[model samples]
Target: MLGASTWNADRAQEIVDEHLSLEAPMLPILHALQEEFGYVAPEAAPLLAQALNLSRAEVHGVISFYHDFRHEPAGRHVLKLCRGEACQSMGSEELAEDLFTKLGLDWNRTTRDGELTVEPVYCLGLCASSPAALIDGEPIARLDATTLGEAVDEARGL
Candidate 1:
């Protein structure tokens, strides 16, 4: 686990060294940090700022702006349900409510078991097949209660 303290000068250089050549530098670095550490430790914001020559606020802003960046730990499986207009038009709101009740969770929150998380995604770009969702990042379309339940069960390895 990369502790927050480890994100100081030395690690800043490491982040820069790894992604400086890339067109969008921070993506890889942040992804690496998040992948290894579970979340980007607060210390990373400043270190990334210095390495990227961006203001600390800018670095923090970027992290906060992206839905993928988690300041805290998340469940092993994240269920991102689409909340876009197309989805909502197709009864996604009702679906979302039912999902929350079934999972005993609210949007952007994790279940008590720490195995599943429920999050709202604006769109999955599968709007034509409205009421889409992603289970552990895999697109699932035409979700109904049974399909959603089965997917959630599968995600939990049940």
Candidate 2:
């Protein structure tokens, strides 16, 4: 997993301040916070709102709207399965369901061992390789349950 630091209000404030000069600082601030802390700390919303002269709701809205912005830290390995029409048509859904069951996880949930977090992505631009997935951002095309399982195991160092 990425070595994200523990949440610190002071550090978060500094990050917000650093980007205050930008024309559109909200996204940058949020990304910075996530980069530092793995996920945007809930406490950050108010700090961002106050710094940017925006409502807390607005800050939160942006956070929630972006699928890439995780509310909680992800597991050591993140498996992003493509769920676009092509992938779905190619049986990604079935493969995903089997993997989810095996891992005892639901979408966006982490495994009990913290080894993996499974997420659904809209597209990976690998339609020709439908049923693709990304393991820690490394694309795996032509995915099957066995291949996906092996990838996850390898990522877990099993």
Over the stretch 1-158, how does candidate 1's per-residue lDDT look in tens digits?
11223334465557668887888788788887776666777888878887778999999998998878888867878889999999999899999899888778899898887888888999889999988999987889998888988998998889
Tens digit per residue, CA lDDT, model 2, 40-96? 878988998899888999989988999878888889888889999999999999999
Model 2, global lDDT: 0.89
Q: What is the C-alpha RMSD of each candidate to the true structure, in Å?
A: 3.7, 1.4
Best by TM-score: 2
- Please give the distance, in angstroms, between residue 62's alpha carbon in candidate 1 and its true position after superposition: 2.3
Model 2, residue 126: distance off in Å is 1.0
Q: After superposition, how far is residue 103 of candidate 1 from its true place, in Å?
A: 2.2
Clashes of each: 0, 0
TM-score of each: 0.83, 0.92
lDDT of 1: 0.82
Q: What C-alpha lDDT do the candidate models reach, one value each?
A: 0.82, 0.89
